[model samples]
Target: MSVIYGLLTISILVALVFLIVFIFSVKSGQYDDSYTPSVRMLFDDELVKDDSKKSSTQEQKQD
Candidate 1:
């Protein structure tokens, strides 16, 4: 049917757009740090070390 042809054409166009976007992202370093994200949670506490230090100082002042 004509409707089926139209749907197929639209789907292919959408898929090609997504492919181009993905390729652009890859070339722009979007996936370069793949490992970091997977291990980022393990280092979340380290990222807030200054906050912990601030809390400790506050606790000392309270004492």
Candidate 2:
């Protein structure tokens, strides 16, 4: 029936659009960092500020 054909066509179009978007994302490196980001967030940022403070203190000591 025509309704079945229309439904099939719409479904196919939606799938094709999703496929295109997936391909684009893969090409753009959207899926590259699958795990690193989660682990990165768990790590502390204290070392960064500590390093900066240490460097400044050393500079002051040198001067």
Candidate 3:
């Protein structure tokens, strides 16, 4: 019985801590980039292609 009470109290404290941290993160613009992440993958391939082109050009110049 006493052990159960202790466990319950600990769990509640842990939950409250997590809730507070989440609230702080929200207020601090942690989630502000809501759109970029979703669309970022769409542009990733283009970026990789551009990078490879630039590297190849640089290698040609060096050689």
lDDT by residue (1-63, candidate 3, tens digit) is 999999999999999999999999999999898898889989999999999999999999999
Native-to-model Cα distance after best TM-score fit, residue 34 in candidate 1, in Å: 7.4
Compared with the true structure, all predictions reach lDDT values of 0.94, 0.92, 0.98
Q: Which parts of model 2 are misplaced by more than 4 Å?
A: 34-63
Q: Pull out the clashing pairs in model 1.
A: none
Local accuracy of candidate 2 as per-residue lDDT tens digits, 1-63: 999999999999999999999999999998897898888776657777789999999999999
Query: Cα RMSDs of all predictions?
Result: 6.9, 9.4, 7.5
The parts of candidate 1 lying over 4 Å away from their true place are 34-63
Pick the winner on TM-score between candidates 1 and 3. Answer: 3
Tens-digit lDDT track for model 1 on 10-59? 99999999999999999999878778888998888986997899999999
The global Cα lDDT (0 to 1) of model 2 is 0.92
- The true-versus-predicted C-alpha distance at residue 40 of model 1, in Å, is 12
Each prediction's number of clashing residue pairs: 0, 0, 0
